[model samples]
Target: MLKNLKLTTSIIMLSSLLVLVAGCGSKKANDSKKEISVALNSELSSVDVSLAMDNTSSDVMEQVGEGLYDFTAKGGVKPALSTNKPKATDHGKKYVFNLRKDAKWSNGKPVTAKDFVYSWRRTVDPKTKSPQSYYFDGVKNYQAIANGKKAPSSLGIKANGKYKLEVTLDRAMPYFPSILAVSASFPLYQPYVEKQGKKYGTDAEHTLYNGAFTLKGWNGSNGEWSYVKNKDYWNAKHVQLDKVNVKVYKTEQTMVQQYQAKKIQFTQISGSTVKNLKKDQDLTVRKIPGNQYLVFNVKENKLFANQKVRQALAMAVDSNKLTKHVLQDQSLPATGYVPYGFNNSKTGKDFAKQAGQLVQNNKTKAQKLWAEGLKELGMTSAEFSILSSNTETAKQVDEYLQSQFETTFKNLKVRVAAVPFNSRLSKQNSGDFDTVLSGWTPVYADPTDFLNLLMTNNNNNNGKWSNSEYDQLIKDANDKYALDEQKRWDNMEAANKIAVEQAPIAPLFYISQVYLKDPNLKGMMLGPLGQPYYKDASYK
Candidate 1:
């Protein structure tokens, strides 16, 4: 989700190496007549929309499940399962939707408005413990249900009949429709979900599909999967490819080898690999709105609780050098928490530019801060490890930070704790990390999408860093000044500044993903967040 419209902040556990290319030799022999193969850097963990915390699962969900609204290529919102744009009433606090009668799940069951209501309730149900529960904070009673103060059935969404749905919000959110466009907001067939129970979404057979394609060959832990055209989908006629095969290749060199051998049509490459492929006609360089940041475990790790320590670590690494030398791609050094050009002022100035630079590389300042922090903790030296995904890019990036921190702070010892993408997310969620390299892909385009995550007791605030003023500023942006565009901008700008200045989470960079795709592979929509959708893709 990276379009100007409803962007969802689904956690990207690992940045995927998305690549597509025309193949020759053995790769061509195994594929179906109208199929293409691509690559993923990590495992496809889950298909359950409510439980999908990673971008890979979210990407798959977008193709297998239909949401009420979908993002248009021109950054507008368009109806997906719904018949037309939702009719807003009650001062934009309520919405009415009419469903398409022709839509059907892969199992041949008719899709009804009830599916939306059930899906929403399931996400906010405390028992479900969905990672996406916080995404519905704007829905009436959603917060109470998520907090266990109310039942999920009390959530303010209802099926008026077989084909009509109505939703009420706690307050008017102009971007609520954008939320509806995300995979987290997709409908689920309640009967099938209940029938499979714990086994639902564990594999292709256990999951239901209602979008452009149905997932196949995935057995939950497998490294390979396929997206086959969904004949039951209402808009199947526009879906071109018969199938899109995806396989996981952990190393950049291996991915490049696969691309060179024509075994995979798409693959992500970086560093020297990108330089070598820069002249390729099918190479694509895309700058995304997502951000990679360092999350400090301030609650459990007292070392990070000291503002000076956090600041020291944040400042030690030269982001400019890291992006230019270590990353070796189009990734930009982060100026602040929000990425550049992500949001614009009423007059069209970018939010990141308006906030100005709050973080900088200062070896002297970092040294001073480290000394002061050590003295504050009554210690001469300290040791900590950085947690990161084991993906090729993450390993290289974390290795660089480890060297920078150790070299800059002579008294401090730093270690790199590299784990699989799923393990990293689990550790981050359980606060089982010292400091983790975390990434966020906005579910929507607004700054609140990122700022909201750091607020006091926010579900996604794995670091447990809290500030009352920061919380108030974000609240004012979404509540007090929501109706006033200029005032809302002011609140968000203030909040962003506070987050960076505090250094509880050190903003890193915005990814400029480089990949290869065959010139004949057309119709793929690379969303604003840099994840490509292959439903409309076809081989020429």
Candidate 2:
């Protein structure tokens, strides 16, 4: 009996040990299951949707800030917080939207139409000092409010009851719905903003989200942030990922290292790294429209005030070689303000080629023009500095341009000034630099977004290039009484022609976006608007 009892006890002990071992193994497997990690080259500048400018911060905010409308992977506009498409009335000036009753903030407060109205008013209010105030020009009285001549209440947004929101545009904008899809134009929760007061959006606790994810742990200065699934999100059932991990690195080398270590699943590669990773299974490259150019400070430098001098400087740079050899992305050389893929009509020759023919490559013509401009300005040798961000890519491009301009233009001394990105932007905005390198991704898939950036009165027009004709063209396009697509296109194209001919801004090649994705990841989509959609993104 004793021997039998000993054997049975041993069997029970063995069974318990096996159960514990299996439990631990299962837990390890669960932990090892695939999770998506993204490594960015910069830190989040701000979580405030209206203030986000950089890609890294914008990417995170897109997942956290729920817009009434969203762009799908297939480039189709879809409803997110809205129940359906907005209704237009009063000759396209007024818009009515019905919010989803189920939409709630991450803090469990009901999201109402008042939230959008408050957000719009705040963005246009002069006291807010929003860098994106230019976007509100489409709204009625926004310009007056931004100039401090009108009250914020005069802005054209209203709340009817608890769920209905109304907006009045200064003019009919066919792309208005698309504009709402951008984070910069998205609505913020009013109560949440008021509750946080001055601390709003500086930390994870200060902001409220109504999207698929809610920020859990984030300090503004640190590069590390994590987003956990929002249980209160109206469409939480469709959210597949449990969490998203974002790690920021200032350089691509550091990001690539983390990616190689399997700590991150996605990154952007360029230059030598692009060549090195060409054969990697996870590497994928696509040609997208992004333009980099040198904008002359005509307001500060009299040399750039002359159209011939501007044109001469533009002609001196070999854009084709810069795109083909330096960028190595098969990028088409730029010759106009609007990018080729940026469409204003349904049919035409590619914009890039058509614009290229208008401005032919001729170094001899450029030299003569430069000589004439020098005589007009009464300067023996033109000396001006080009300011750019201190990124490695910017450094390389600056060096290349310095060599090209010095070699081509006789009696010209080109100096490069590199500063941090934020500081560089501040300097450019203050008109403290002679020339600056910058680019714009259109807020919508329209030519106006790019053209409007150079308008004389536009706040975002860093170059401060002003012309009555240019302003008139933009004004006519925005006249409340007119609603003609063909006329609008003509006016915009005319403005673009003027911009190119005047050469206040040098056109550069449209950039191609390159991103790396792991084999296990799926549903990751990149849009022409330059925003990443993570709503449907998942990993196996």
Candidate 3:
């Protein structure tokens, strides 16, 4: 989701640009007959909401699965299956949602509140082993249920009749609606899922769709798939695109070549290719709310466990050079874990600005720390591999980092282990790598979304960098200051500073997506989390 594997598809929440291809000629607006072909760099891992962990799968899920709420293109929330916004009660710990009876699953069965209840329970059920189960941390009894200490039925969600749903949380979450909008929070038809069992979401046929489109032509192992408009969807009339054909291209060069040939409507390009296409009218760029960072395996790697070593590795990379030369995608050098554009509600100041520069690029300081660390560890030299996705962008970035690390730090041998995207994810999740090129796209707008990943014992903490103070700061932000907006913001700022000072993960750059887009494609929406929504898109 780089919002989870939001990579351009990733394991620690990476974000990728949406690449579409369509006919070159001008067309009528809202052309219902029009269809567009697109490209992905990786294959979809799964469509099952509970099981999907990568950005590719999450992208597909976003198209085919309708949640209680949907993110608007303008970075706001809108009711989808729910009749309206839920009414919060019980001092903001309880929520009541009334469903729209018109909502239906792909099977033509009504989408009732029970479906939501079941979906939440299934995610937190230990038997499901959902990687996303930790998303329900504040939901009452969720942790116990996930830990196998309580029954899934005891989770604080219940269906009131067939249309109304009630949710009780252990603590108030002001951004709960954003959480609900995530694909992992989308409902699944119990009967259908049970019937499909392990086969569910393995392919298009085994899965069900209820959003703007239905997944088709995907066999779980193929490099291509289709999103066909769902006639049975409650809002089907609003979905203008008739079909979207998706294919996977292993390199940006191939995607750009397809764009140049007028065979595709959209594609993302990076590095020197972006410079080459700077004069092209079709070139479009937008800043996405995501960060690419270096993850250190502190739990297992003796060399990285030392804070000085981690700090040295982080400071060695010149983010400005990396983004300007190596990336050349206009991605901003990260100020900290949280990227730019997200603002404090009270002061309207950018969070990154308020936090100030936490990790600085200083070769002198890096060398000093490296020497101190080596001495402390009783080692003259160290060697380890940097694991990263085999995408062209990742390869280039890691290669640059390898050069930077090796040349800056004496006696440090950094090997680049470039594997397929999914394989890299597996190694990260299993804590199998020495250091990893990881990234995160916020699932929600709040700073907590990015900060939550590094907290001790977090499911997404692949590096297992733990600090009691850092954990406390995050906990206080979510729990003690949950109702106090200013306090929450302050605590999160503190936590961000703490994470940066410790340098378990080196915040490299804030992702700025560069795309080659056809001007004909109109009304295509990008969610706040960086995934594109094509429900409103049509060729013009």
Candidate 4:
């Protein structure tokens, strides 16, 4: 979530890369016991930890960088560069993270508290324009520094000594330690970042690794890259895979073909192809905490501005059909903005179960609402386009939505604009299209991460949808209702209900990562955030 925030895709570049993958399906054949081959759905967007925000970029950063803490595949936090979990004081607002004395960067520089302090300040700097900066909202003076009201140096974080870092927050953050594991909060190598200047993280050579692996031979332009074991990493002895070669295969068919030929040890398959692949014992399904939804530009499209019309559009789409037939991955249909697995802190019952299905298919009722909405707007017909990314799954979903919207509403002319993922994000940010088919991988496991987007003028609210009462509900969920578990969930449930009935955005499905891997591959654990943690991974 540049604070939902990451920053885009080049159309020509992706198309060219797809062609390259098709021609070189059997390329990069040098796999060994110390190494493995893998595939990425998208290229690394950027290498700069402070600037990296997309899921792909974040994944790459996970290999090459380490935060104070590292997230585990089993939904636990592990010590990484930090010697231990942060010591909290002031009722959880003040945290002091101690760095490991032996933790060293790839370049042999000791990892220090100063590096983290510099990285945090750099991200919050208004001039950096890092989208991830908004995640620092509650930190002391973050708003002031981010809004240019104060100097970056005055931000809450400070280094007590070379290895000790002290951070002050404005309020209690129950998941602050987990947030530290996110790539945006990772430490930066000051001398390297400063010397390389704007070119830092543009290539592997510019950035130094402190984690289990170091990005090697990545020129910042190629879709193919690799991560090799970093000899200087503190925990290098336990990292069994000496190297991981990552290739970006644009089409699912090509990716499957490559996987079948033993060229790609890991690759994603289209939902329609899953049945045939199930015979192969290595096929696996990993459900993730990500949501794919439709964001409507109420400000740009007068038709969408009518609450009734938005509700009609939402009701017409059957998420079950899309998930079962189209997705075919055992992916759960989304009930609310939040996914199904997360428990309500108060009840321990599933949050989605509590919220229930907000929008359901009601053809007769939806048609009536459509007619009434059109009449209310004093219009006989309206035309709008749905924007989406250029991916196999995205294409299928876009087609499904286009068919549903056009067939459901007699007077509506619907179109779809599919571009590369990064380009799709650019269009959404500029408010270029009507309803955009976009998704958010959770930055952290919290209802607030999803609910906060609906707040009026929130950075991730690309649709410009606003509701004063809804905003207050979310505000209370984060503030007055925070400490009280029951009240906080109540506030979240209330706010999400309002958003759903209003239909600013429509929930589609929670993502389930369906892929084919070599049977020999073991310990390749995919974490809750929808990324694989390769640190503990090794051959069976």
Which candidate number would show the highest lDDT if scored against the true structure?
3
**lDDT (Cα) of model 1:** 0.79
Off by over 4 Å in 1: 2-26, 29-33
* lDDT ranking of the models: 3, 1, 4, 2
Q: Clashes in model 2: which pairs?
A: 290-511
Question: Which ranking of candidates, highest TM-score first?
Answer: 1, 3, 4, 2
Better of 2 and 4 by lDDT: 4
**lDDT tens string, model 4, 117-228?**
9999999888887868877877899867866789999988999999888999977766566677788899998888899999888888878778889998789768778889
Of the pair 1 and 2, which is ahead by lDDT? 1
Compared with the true structure, model 1 gives a TM-score of 0.94
lDDT of 4: 0.75
Error of 2 at 355 (Å): 3.9
lDDT of each: 0.79, 0.69, 0.80, 0.75
lDDT-superior candidate, 1 or 4 = 1
Pick the winner on TM-score between candidates 1 and 4.
Answer: 1
Best candidate according to TM-score: 1
Q: Candidate 1, residues 198-314: lDDT per residue as tens digits?
A: 999889989999988899889878777778999998988888788777777777787777676767677667766777778888787766667889999999999999999999989
TM-score, one value per model = 0.94, 0.87, 0.92, 0.91
- How displaced is residue 137 in candidate 3, in Å? 2.1
- Tens-digit lDDT track of model 3 for 71-180: 76555567888877865788878988889889888889989988998889998888887778878889999767867789999999999899998889998876676678
